[model samples]
Structure formats: structure tokens, C-alpha cells
Target: MKRVYAKEDVCIGCRLCEIACVVEHSESKNAIRTYKTEVPRPVARNVVEERGPLTFSVNCRHCDEPLCVAVCIAGAMVKDEESGVVRHNEEKCVGCWSCVMICPYGVIKMKPAAKKVSKCDLCNGRTMPACVQACPNRAIVYEER
Candidate 1:
């Protein structure tokens, strides 16, 4: 299965990836509208991390054996056998934070206002994820190893 990977060496940490992700997942799908008018604020599934001079983006790894799936008490976290994508169902989520605590990558994020967790879903229904496409440096790539 194809996954998103970040090449830290070339990452400039511009964080356009995060904005693109918000737009892709937003109701309006417009950068200005999403950032300006959206209520509750749409969260980016992928995040850019920086320490000193080193920077890179982080998102779900969609591991073959994801601990988040195992620890989800409400069964909201599921790994698609066919695509190998781990998805979080907001409707079924109880906001217990089990998946948040168990994710080894620490990519799962808490949405306090919505009482749900958010993580990378590989931009579902897109041929390429928003993060990968928005990466000007080509630091982030979507491909299978």
C-alpha cells in the first residue's frame, strides 16, 4: 500500500502541507474560507515538526499492526485490510483517547471541542494526498516501498 513519507533532508518546514490538508478536509475547500470562516477550525491531519535546524512532517504511518486499532474501546479506529489505511470514525468515537495514547507515532491528535481524535487518512478519495502535492520542496512523497 502506498504511504506518505517525508524526506527530512530537503524539508524546509514551510508548513504549506498543513494548510493544504485543512483545505482538503474542510467543508468549503477554500484556503481563505477554511482558515477565516470555519467554525471549530478544521485540523490538519499532518503536522510539521521542527527542532533546532532540523524539520520534518509527521503523520500516520498506517502500520501493519497498529496499536491504535487495538486500544480503541469504541471500535472507531480501524485498519482497512485492502488499502492498509488506518481510519478513525468520528461517529463511533467515544473520545476516550485510547487510540491517542496507544499510537506509537504520536500522530493522533485530540479534538477537544468535537471530543474526537484526528489523524492522517491519506486524503481519502484523492489520487495523491494534499500534503504531498503541496510540498514545494518535494520533501514529502506518496509511494510504496
Candidate 2:
């Protein structure tokens, strides 16, 4: 199964990954409308983190044994056996924050208004994740490794 991975050494901190993620998840799927007109804009599932001169994108690892899936009491977090993608079902979520607390990478985020948690779903339906495609430096890659 393929997963998204970050190449920290080559990352340039452009943050195009974040923007692409938001746009890809948006209802309009248009950058201009998603940023300028969309109300309650969709959040980026991936985040770019910086520490002084170092920067890299952070996202769910979709672990072989994801703790987030294990701790989700409402069974909202699930891992697809074939694809190895950890998916979050907002409708089934109970807003318990169990997944949030158990996520070791701190990638899962809580949606305060909806009382639901969100995480990287690998830009479902896309050939490649938005973040990996938007990365100008090829800092993010989707592959079996």
C-alpha cells in the first residue's frame, strides 16, 4: 500500500502543500474561491511545521497498527485493509477526542464547530495526494515505502 512521506532535507517550506490540501477538500475545488469566498473554509489535513531554519510537512502516517483507530470509541477512525489508509468518518464520530489524544504524530485535529476530528485521508479519489503533488521541491512523495 502507498503512503505519503516527507523528505525533510529537501523541504523548502513553501506551504503550497497546505493550500493545495484545503483547495482539494473544498466544495469548489478552486483555489481562488476556496480562499477568498468560501465560508468556514475546509481545513488542510496536512500541516507544514517549522523550527527555526528547519521545516517539513506533517501528516498521518497511516500506521500498520494505528493508535488513533484503536482508541476511537465511536469507531469513527478506521484503516482500510487493502489500501492501508486511515480514514475518519465524521458522521460516526462522537467527538470524544480519543483519536486526538492517541495520535502520536499529533496530526489528527479537532473541529470545534462540528465537534469532530479530522486527519489526512490521502485526498481520496485523486491520483496522488494534493500535498505530494503540490510540493515544488518534491519534498512529499506517495509510495509503497
Candidate 3:
């Protein structure tokens, strides 16, 4: 399976990936409309973390042994064996922070308005995640290893 990977050596901290992700997941799917209209209030899945001289974008790893899936009290998170992708069920979610607390990478975030937990689902099995596609410097990539 292909997964998103970051090459911190090349990262320039532009954060275009974050912007693209918000737009791609936005309700209107238009960059101008999403920001101008604030439709659905754009949220980013991946975030760039900066060090003194280095930066890297981070998101869900979709681990082989997913702690988020195991800790989800409402049975909202599940791992797919075929795709090695972990998906969250918004309808079943109860806004419990169990998954968020258990995720070692701290990728999961609480959607306070909707009272839901949100993370990267690799763009729900798209050919490539929006973040990877929108990387201006190719610091992020989707690859099989």
C-alpha cells in the first residue's frame, strides 16, 4: 500500500499541503469560496512542525497495530486489512477523546464545533492524498515501501 511520507530535508515549511488538504476536504471544494465564505470552516489534517532549522509535516501513520482503533469507545475507528487504512465513523463517534489521547503521534484533533475527532484517512483511499499532491517542494510523497 502507498502511504504519505515526508522528507524533512527538503521541507521549506510553506504549508501548502495543509492548505490543499483543507480545501480538498472542504464542503465547497473551492479555495476562494472556502476562505471567503468560510463554508464549513476549513480544517487541516496534516500540520507542519518546525524545529530550529528543520520542518516536517505530520499526519496519521495508519499503524499496523492502531491504538486509536482500540481505544475508540464508540467503535468509531476501524482499520481496514485490505488497504491498511484506518477509517473513522463520524455517525458513531461520540466525541470521546480516547483515540486522541492514545495516538502517540498526536495527529488526531478534536472538532470542537462538531464534537468529533478528526485525522487523516489518506483522503479516503484516493489515488493520492491532497497533501501529497499539493506539496510545492515535493517534501511529501505517497509511496509503497
Model 3 spans > 4 angstroms off: none
Q: Could you estimate the TM-score for every candidate?
A: 0.98, 0.96, 0.95
Candidate order by lDDT, decreasing, is 1, 2, 3
**Best model number under TM-score:** 1
Expressed as tens digits, the lDDT of each residue in 1-145 for candidate 1 is 9999999999998999999998999999999998899997788888789998799999999999999999999999999999999998999999999888887778998999899999999999999999999999999999999
lDDT for model 2, on a 0 to 1 scale?
A: 0.90
Each prediction's whole-model lDDT (CA): 0.93, 0.90, 0.88
Q: All candidates: CA RMSD in angstroms?
A: 0.7, 0.9, 1.1
Clashing pairs in 3: none
lDDT of 2 by residue, 33-143 (tens): 999998888888887889987899999999999999898899889999988889899999999998888888889887878888888999988999999999999999999
Clashing pairs in 1: none
* Candidate 1 residue-pair clash tally: 0
What residue pairs are clashing in model 2? none
